[model samples]
Target: MADATPYEDSTTPSPTVLSQDITLNWKTKATVRLYRPAVIPPKKKLPLIIYLHGGDFVLYSASTVIYHNFCNDIAAAFPAIVISVEYRLAPENRLPAAYFDGLNAVLWAQNQSLGIGGQDPWLEYADFTKTYLLGSSAGANIAYHVALQLLDYDLRPVKIKGLLMNQAFFGGLTRTQSEKNLIEDAYVPLYVNDVLWSLALPTYMNRDHEYCNPISGGSYMGRVKGLPKVYIKGDYGDPLVDRSILLAQYLQSCKVPVYYRFNQGGYHGIELQNTSAAQQLYNDMTWFVNDVYQNLNSQDLSHHHASY
Candidate 1:
């Protein structure tokens, strides 16, 4: 059952930024907040970043103050149009509900790209060909599932060039060393983490379910091989750090293009709370996005040469 009381901070005032909220599905109240740069170049189409906010899948919304601030910074830094998805949370909607909302967000983007959806001024300057999925913690989990869902169909005019996962939220039935040794901090306490998982995961599934633990082999392992280029950043002190390492190793074993970075002396979701760390991660993400675009161009050039 869903928690009747909503989080107090969920509706906190957001920093002054150029953003607008739109409803993707009126029935389910699924919506997304679109953020744009303070200044837009004439007739310039920038890369699109579809962001998912982290809240252990049971708390927070796209309008949450921390998430809104983070998206604003990202939009200004990367000069990219960001669409922060407001998916239905768990307990109320459950596991696959969030996943479906994510897919709907992507489909909405596709429609906007084609000019079939309702008018959105920001979409006019959105470069769908370079769209990227950006998420933090539980949001990253949603991004991963959305990427997998897209594999079954063609999303023309809207290409998912890469995935940027920061402090991804994943769990297993067995505890890792970090989980056992690390003391619960302000960001995420061990007991709270367990409770959140119990509330978010499917009623019939455990921590090892593929939705919660991507590395837990089932159908997930088979689908991982063809995923888009991925960039993962994790904190050494985070309990989920080992999960990131394991995921990186698995992607490598499957020959998937992946880049993983571990930040020492940090904790889960530190980037949002710390200014310097947030700037550095933003810089890293900017570089990664540029590199992905460069690689895509090179591939195009090679195909052109082959055709000649």
Candidate 2:
């Protein structure tokens, strides 16, 4: 089930500075990019964020324009270690391929912290207790699934700050009115979604499977209880907007704290551009992080559940 070296065409080169880049020879050779703050040893262990870039699970790459920009922006904003995973795309490598790559990258990131100076950087500079998981579009799907996997493996971080799923993609066979509306929309037509599913799936598979669409599989509702808080955002006009809403509802029903935001303008990829949409998203994410930190540290760990 694991073919870490699936991406034979894409290779990540070594970092020129303190940061390094390498492929985890697992499911596919995932192009893992590590960004270290342009600073020497600091007094504190920095938080680490593992960001998964989205490209419809088939179209984009870690080097893509938007994904690249987003990585830089987050690294600058948080001034922490940021690791971006370039998982295998669909059609060439299907469904669970990306999921496994995501998990492996996280595991790698967890280990990398220890070697920042001589050991793996994932464990070195990273305060694993403050680890954060984030992604956009299809990458969000990977993040969500991996978050669940992290919980399952009992590898939960001491402090899973939050999950930032921007324009998340979560759905299945049953489409919503918003999804139906976008069936013919120029941005993301139904045919394109069908192709995405085909590429994302291994050989021939069900799109509603837990690995493909967690919401449809009823897996999301069951495991959202103790999961870390989630921040979801999307545009009202987007096809998968309903999926975000439905997922947020499920999370809320499970008593999970969810920060949901939806706007009326912008297309699926518009948020990647440095426009009003992107600024709004960036602002919300910053606020969400601050809120989580304040809320988490405000109370003693012994009485954490009481505050929630």
Candidate 3:
């Protein structure tokens, strides 16, 4: 995974961070930070953004080196409540475990109103009509899979708005340009892709199955047709970049409304590098969020749900 963003010269304000804590399994406790402007929020409730950090689904968490910082920056930049899930790692908890945790986290946030504090009205509070699911790398894969599950369960939250995938993970049967050309790229090589699937497949029980390859999964594709608008971001240099592009193509082919942006420079997850590229991507994300949230008011969402 191309987890680091290239360094660039720019002057941007630092992020203001707050805390969100949750205990899922009895032995595992996780804490994620919420970032926002120091100024008092204009509304009691704002849009919610739940993020799943990517470390090839094995190496990282909310406590990892970059996860906390990324969450803080996103919250500070966007006028939204951001919840980062610190899921269990693979080779230990394995595939379905992470997906299960992510799904529960979303449901929990929808009901909890206030995050960990339960008293800090601004922390976990959100307008259900504008909740978003976002993640990078393997986290992106989880986001897509979990969204499919949400659709199947008829548990689509009234407030759930859309999905944002930064350098998403989606592998098709055919080869993509990034996969063909960047087989040995430093960040994400073809071999790494195979390894991730190996780790994630145990959860699905079939590496080639729909739960693993959502595009081919009949149930997932059916759910995708009913999903909210999607936004995907990627770069040309990264191996999985083409995967994101192809997924966008598939979604568009299926007539799903999708917002796609392909950056020119940098490799995978460059937007998380804490650089100018990262800031630009952040701005784009917030703009997309504001636009979608503003338009996805209760009535609009209700209509969509009715159609579903």
Candidate 4:
């Protein structure tokens, strides 16, 4: 998979877009690619978006050309600072490895926001207080796990206001109607999904594991209650659509604020392949981010008044 190069660097140079790669942890070989708008006034801070690229947990990295292009485009479109995390993959690093790396990346971002970590020009304008965790496919799964981990600790000035899962990769022991119907697709086939789960999940664990299937219950049910507002997108033709639906229902059951969008006649990862679809998804995401920002401001104001 590493030898397979999907596309040449087709990223159009934009005066408004600027990006750089930074190492998060040397020992774990975890890295992050930071993207932000080039123009910013003095003391201006932008919402920080920590992006996890999708590759079924075993395929791609932040350096992948396609993902790099996606991150660059979104950074410019949203006009926010995007930190695309390069977590350790599976079959070599396995389950929990990527999750740990993701958490570490968030912590590293926190340190940067607090001015304790090594300097980076982009992070200087990052508003960690209004952070968002976003991912697609397996990356979205990683983002979910990382958010759960974050709940265990108190992170001041680095609040995770929302989570955006674009066609999130999730499965279970039982087959859904979409999965049975859409055996083969352009992005990810049924067999490929099965293989990815095998490679990513622990040896003893099956598809029912909480890592692969959050609704399988165990720890996830308890953790789901405190999760931030979640926005989930699903493709009609994708096999994983049911998984997203189930997740939305589960979140709603837990009384967590959840927003979901399902696209018609779309396959898994269609946004990455279709320009129009990608643009629409980006627009939706921007709206979600704006809504979250307004809520954050209101919450802060309420807290301030209560403190007084």
lDDT of 2 by residue, 125-203 (tens): 6677777888898889889888887777644444567888888766577767787767797777878887778777767
Which sequence of candidate numbers ranks them by TM-score, best first?
A: 4, 1, 2, 3
Q: Residues 40-127, candidate 1: write the lDDT tens digits.
A: 8899988899999999999999989899889988998888999899998989888989888889889889988877746487678899
1 against 3, candidate with superior TM-score: 1
- Measured against the true structure, the TM-scores of the candidates, in listed sequence, are 0.88, 0.81, 0.81, 0.89
Clashing pairs in 1: none
Candidates' RMSD to native: 8.3, 7.4, 8.1, 7.9
Best by lDDT: 4
For model 2, state the Cα shift of residue 267 in Å.
1.5
Which model is ahead, 2 or 3, in terms of lDDT? 2
**Model 1: per-residue Cα lDDT at residue 201:** 86
True-structure Cα RMSD, model 2: 7.4
lDDT of all predictions, in order shown?
A: 0.80, 0.69, 0.68, 0.81
Candidate 2, residue 282: lDDT: 66
Candidate 2 lDDT score at position 143: 91
Candidate 4 lDDT for residue 91: 95
Off by over 4 Å in 1: 1-17, 292-308
lDDT of 4 by residue, 220-302 (tens): 67878999998888877888888887777778778888776777789878888899989888888888888843221111111
* Candidate numbers, best lDDT first, in rank order: 4, 1, 2, 3
